[model samples]
Target: MINEVILDDFSLKVTSFEQGVSTSSSGTEAKTIRFDFEVRGGTEYHDVTVHLYKNTFDVKVPELDLSFRGTINNYSTSRTDFTNENSSSLFRLELIEIG
Candidate 1:
């Protein structure tokens, strides 16, 4: 089964964009539009949590696919990397960006 990562209330800001050590004031030169914040939810009860980074892939619309990176529990601390662990559970969380 394929999982989808949803981007709700998504907004990106271009703080700076440089090419070959030169900054471009024009919007065309903007290379990085940071998705500083986002909200994610799961459809399954045991969907766990979703952790995001630049390396992660984006999910399609309508369905929000979530991927979490961390300890399942402090006592158990089982490390897992799954695309579809708990697809039936529904969960939501906020993603905040701090510079």
Candidate 2:
């Protein structure tokens, strides 16, 4: 099973991970990487999204020996408020290849 993902400087332990390809209008295919993980607490949530949003990342899957430069094609979280220390939510991130 795909367990972990490295995005930029963050090493995230994922609950699920997938690699895919998408064909554009020009008929060129590009790699698409997606994963699901959990984020807990307000501080942790902020820490994770602060530098990642709207930025290109060096994505890596060490076990599969795959790496690419990509940006966040999609990002979603289960909860918007994580002020409670015990708060936790699932996060899904999808990265699309640059070229």
The per-prediction tally of clashing pairs is: 8, 0
Put down candidate 1 lDDT per residue, 1-99, tens digits, no spaces. 113324333222212211121134552321111112212233321222333323232322232223222111111112333345342221222222111
- Distance (Å) between predicted and true CA of 48, model 2? 0.4
Please give the CA lDDT of all the candidate structures: 0.25, 0.88
- Per-residue accuracy of model 2 over 58-86 as CA lDDT, tens digit each: 88999999999988899899998888868
Task: Please give the distance, in angstroms, between residue 60's alpha carbon in candidate 1 and its true position after superposition.
Answer: 12
TM-score of each: 0.18, 0.93
Candidate 2: the clashing residue pairs are none
RMSD of 2: 1.1
Please give the distance, in angstroms, between residue 82's alpha carbon in candidate 1 and its true position after superposition.
12
- The C-alpha local distance difference test score for the whole of candidate 2 amounts to 0.88
